[model samples]
Target: MRVHKLTFAALAVAASLPLAACQSSGGGKGQSDPSSAAASTAPSPSDSKASDAKSPAGQGTAAATGSPANGKVDKCRTDELEITAKDNTIDGDPDGTVAVQLKNRGSRDCTMSGYAGVDLKTNSGPVSAKRSGEQAGPAVLKPGKSVAFGINYPVNNSGGSGVRITGLLVTPPDETKSVTLDWPGAATLPVTESPGTPVKVGPIGSAGQGG
Candidate 1:
């Protein structure tokens, strides 16, 4: 009887050893590694984005859109401006300058940069003017204030018969709308009958400054 009991006790001890080995391997599996857990919850650089800022020192919407970050003015629009051509003599043109004046007729201050779109309306359709001059700086137009640009035409200096301009079509910078003004008799452009476009215009500048 004693020998049989000893054999059963030895078998039971061996069986318990395997169960403890299995438990040791599985015990820590339920817990996650601290390093891996931190990585999963952290934000990645690609997921980050910049929010819209106001502008000025190269930060906001103004810098992106080429406007001053001041946010106080906007590009001058067509409906709020009054355009008129002046004879070289009327506005004191420097020798052979053709100038047109643009006045801010709106109640708010307006701003403009770069070139104004210019076209010479004639009996032979429209003649688009080429842009010239150094890059223009921004011009802020106060209520009732004015600005101007010049037209440099390939004048028929040979004094031959040339194309006649009937009117003017002018558009403010960065605007699609346009305004038509009567071609001033003093602001005459006598282009040659040459094939290539010989007309050029200048950037928005002080009236009568050759743009």
Candidate 2:
């Protein structure tokens, strides 16, 4: 009876050893590795720095894309303007004067600076005018607004004995084509047979009534 009890006791001890081994292996699996756990929980230094850097760069790019306040405006075209002239003569002086008006007929605003080109025209040919030494203020013409300049010349009985001016050819600054304005009346610009330097043109101004 004693020998049989010893064999049973040994078999019980062997079964307990296998259970202990299994418990030890399962204990390691329950706790996670320290390095792997930290990697999963926190972002890397490089990744954090990259995220911070991208934010301000994106903001700066957005700011640069906005439009500027003082942008450049476009120049005036010939088809967008209207030209008119009137005789501005003095009673006693033989020096004749014509006030030329430039109206902006288009939809937008335009800039005009410096002197306009002027010439006296007849059936024979064109006589060029000299630019005066005077400088006028810049003109910004909105729609339907107008500017003016002056053209001064001698009358028929003056130094130009036979000079006759049938028409006036006016070219705006920075324009290729010119507009022709007929003489308002015979008294406005007296017809002379002899022609010299028939005219001298002045700078442009905002007030059309004065030079």
Candidate 3:
């Protein structure tokens, strides 16, 4: 009877040891590591795309406008001149002279005239040319009036190869406000042969925003 009782006690003790080991193992897994838990719940790549799609277009445009020198386009009075270049005047070679047109889009008749300067800058310094032109149209632009000015960059003295176009400084009569037709910008003027290069000239690069 005593031997049977001892054997039953030994088995019970062995069973309790396993339960104790299991309880200790459960405590080790009480909580997952914070870093791993966060990773599991993190947003997938597709979620980022979905978030971007919900963003407003105006926000993107605003970012673009502010990107260059905290860039803000100053509206000068009634007329706004839009300047476009034939080529980027950089990277690729220009077949001919880059043409720039100034149009007056305002309620009142406005004059667009100034010393259109082209400064081809290099590592050393800027090589500049000045050519001035004026509009022959009426003094007051009746809602829509346009004027065109073409500047032919001299190939012989252009100096550098990699080039960028700056902008036109448009000065009105009163000169209350000068409009800067800021362009795509400065680059090294490619070296090329001049066939019948018309003499071109303009003001040196001015630090002011206006003409």
Candidate 4:
């Protein structure tokens, strides 16, 4: 009977050992799952620093390109310009050209563009002058610099009507007042009795050899 009691006690202790081992393994698995979840939720330090570095460079580039709100400049004034005419008469040609030079006499920079209004004047009244149909772009004139234009017309070779031109009446672009430049040397301008006659005037360009 004692031997049977010892055998029963050993069986009970052996079953209890497996149950204790199972409880220990379950607690270990639960702790390992929570540790893995914490590692996945945390943010990386390297990724946060890289995002901060790129923001300032983009903002700096935008500020550099956007200065100067208004884009247009001021127009040129007439009183600041000095006007003169140069004789460019070629030999044996009926068509002649007079180069009109305009110098910027002001202290500041200005702009000049388009055709200059020109007319020939005699003792009686103004003669007819046609525009040369030359297109001009805007030209920026620095202080003391000059720009030129050409006045083209026919020479008076006919002996029928003796018309004399004493001076030139020049009007700058977008100006109300006119400037009168005297005829250089013995230069004579062609004259016609008809009204509204055309005188060819070229666009503003670089200063030529004469005037």
**Candidate-wise lDDT, in order:** 0.74, 0.77, 0.47, 0.75
Off by over 4 Å in 4: 1-71, 185-187, 190-198, 206-211
Shift of residue 124 alpha carbon in model 4, Å: 3.6
| Candidate no. 1 TM-score | 0.57
Q: What tens digits encode model 3's per-residue C-alpha lDDT throughout 54-122?
A: 686668888988776743333324235544433323334442344444445554444433444444334
Candidate with maximal lDDT: 2
Candidates 1 and 3 compared by TM-score, better number: 1
lDDT of 1 by residue, 63-124 (tens): 57885566677788888988888755334433354688888899999888889889888777
Deviation (Å) of 114 in candidate 2: 0.7
Q: Under the 3 Å rule for N, CA and C atoms, how many clashes does model 4 have?
A: 6
**Alpha-carbon runs more than 4 Å astray in model 3:** 1-79, 87-95, 112-125, 132-140, 156-187, 190-211
How large an RMSD does model 2 have?
A: 6.3
lDDT of 4: 0.75
Candidate 4, 62-112: lDDT as tens digits: 997886566555556778898988787677766777788888888887887
Instruction: Give the CA lDDT, 0 to 100, for residue 89 in model 3.
Output: 37
Model 2 TM-score, 2 decimals: 0.60
Q: What is the TM-score of each predicted model, taking all chains together?
A: 0.57, 0.60, 0.33, 0.59
